[model samples]
Target: MPSSNDSRVERARIVASFGRQFYVRTLDAPGPDRVAVTRGKRTDFCVGDEVTIRLIGADQAVIERGLSRRSELIRSDRYNVKRLAANVDQAAIVIASDPRFSEELLLRMLLACATAEIPALILANKSDLATAWAAIAPRLQVYRDLGYPVIELAARDHPQETRAALSRYLTGHNTILLGESGMGKSTLVNTLVPGAALATREISAALCAGRHTTTFSKWFDLPSETAPSGAIVDSPGFQTFGLAHVSDSQRVHAMPEYTELIGGCRFHNCSHIQEPGCAIRAALESGAIDPIRYLLFSRLAGRD
Candidate 1:
């Protein structure tokens, strides 16, 4: 709650937002005591959004306007698109062993992050599961060779290591934590930020998927001493992440591995499916490009 004399407009960043209410950290006081604010009927806000708010009453305020957003990460399905986070500098894509792992989803997520122009770091959780780790190691290496950083972490077994590694990646950046349910995203969040006690649930044996634990996106500032200022936003787990907003051209350019060969394709507008003299296929056959990634690209381009 605000003091009786707190009626004024101020700049703030949205730390947590859901429905009509938002938890905003004031520019002057960036800490735990965020003012709870509501939006006007037409006002829209997302986690990491910078906005101006006017305090109208004690502990309450209304968002007056949203500042410009540098970038917006969105997930879409056939039905609709939803904004996951805004103004994030990097994306932390978390994958785990429980409930099984999907390479297709991983590729899609990386592509989405690439298209959004946000660098992504792959956090392979549950490395303590030896059998699962062994099976996923080769695929993980493919991503690593493509120049994306891959950090192996056993969140439960090595909390300190996980926190330290994550802190290094998040330093000086606003990173969004992305993953499917049951992948230990919440658990990682709890480890990274001790004070953030996000709820966690076990994977369902029958369904082979994790139950939804997070219902909304929330941001937490990281503890800083020698490192640059950093923060992370934990988003709710989802079964699917769509890239309907990304164009075919953007998708092709997003993959750094394919960049060198893109210009050599047969057609200037090569779909890369059945086109003759396609350089992408040539590279895949010659072992220059990873076959699995090519397949994933084909699927995304509707060529599969």
Candidate 2:
């Protein structure tokens, strides 16, 4: 039996969210997660959010308010903003050689991560496909040269090697996994979190939405042997990653190659597209910056 006093408030971290329903694990005690919801139309909560909750019953609570977030990854279009996760230490952008992952989407995700002040790494999955790997290896090098760590692994073909290669990165940090469909993101999750499949099934059942695991975000704790203090949040796979929420200046500064050349531009408000003496364009012409990236930037900046 619980009391009717205000002493029922407890700190909790959101572990899963689907639609307006959220599942929060109490930080004050070790117990099963409680289904939580905001008072009114407050639906801003996302997986990995730490919030204060008031227990209304044995298996449910009401989210009182959210704590300050250290970092948040978001994607947006002209109409809506989609929050991916919060309080994550870093992000792992998984891509595969087969099915031809979109570099544009990858860039968008990197930009979002950069704007959110979250470090990102590229996981080049499907390394066992030698022919496809050969074709994309050079492109992967481009990202590596930009100072992002790129780890190659075949999630499906070599589970042990994949786990070993990613263990260091996953240790002691809360990582958010993002990737498009067919990139082995799910396979990697199962490899790192052995019980992830069963957990997903349980989450789906708890949410009363069968077969909706891939459409929602959920958190999984890493095994103690693998990562004592680490956890991973698996987000739904999507083809498009928008950045309409990011301002132009933020986007420009987010690019590693353009950071050093920013002040070199002639005009203080140079858009870097048609502006003469633009340091970015100059670098592009001088072979100092990758042409493909520059083209992508131009397109994103609406100059192409």
User: Candidate 2: how large is its RMSD?
Assistant: 2.2
Query: How well does each candidate superpose onto the true structure, as a TM-score?
Result: 0.89, 0.93
Off by over 4 Å in 1: 1-4, 30-39, 198-212, 225-228, 302-304
The local distance difference test score of each candidate is 0.79, 0.88
Each model's total of backbone clashes: 2, 0
Instruction: List the lowest-lDDT window of 10 residues for candidate 2.
Output: 204-213
**TM-score, prediction 1:** 0.89
Best by lDDT: 2
* Per-model RMSD to reference: 4.6, 2.2
Q: Write the per-residue lDDT of candidate 2 for residues 1-304, one digit (tens) a residue.
A: 5677634889999999988989999987887788888888899999999999998767888999999999989998888888899999899999999987898889998999999999999999998898998999999999989999999998887888887888899999999999897787778888889888887888777667656338788888899777778899888889788888888999999999999999999998998889998998999999999999888878997421
User: What TM value does model 2 have?
Assistant: 0.93
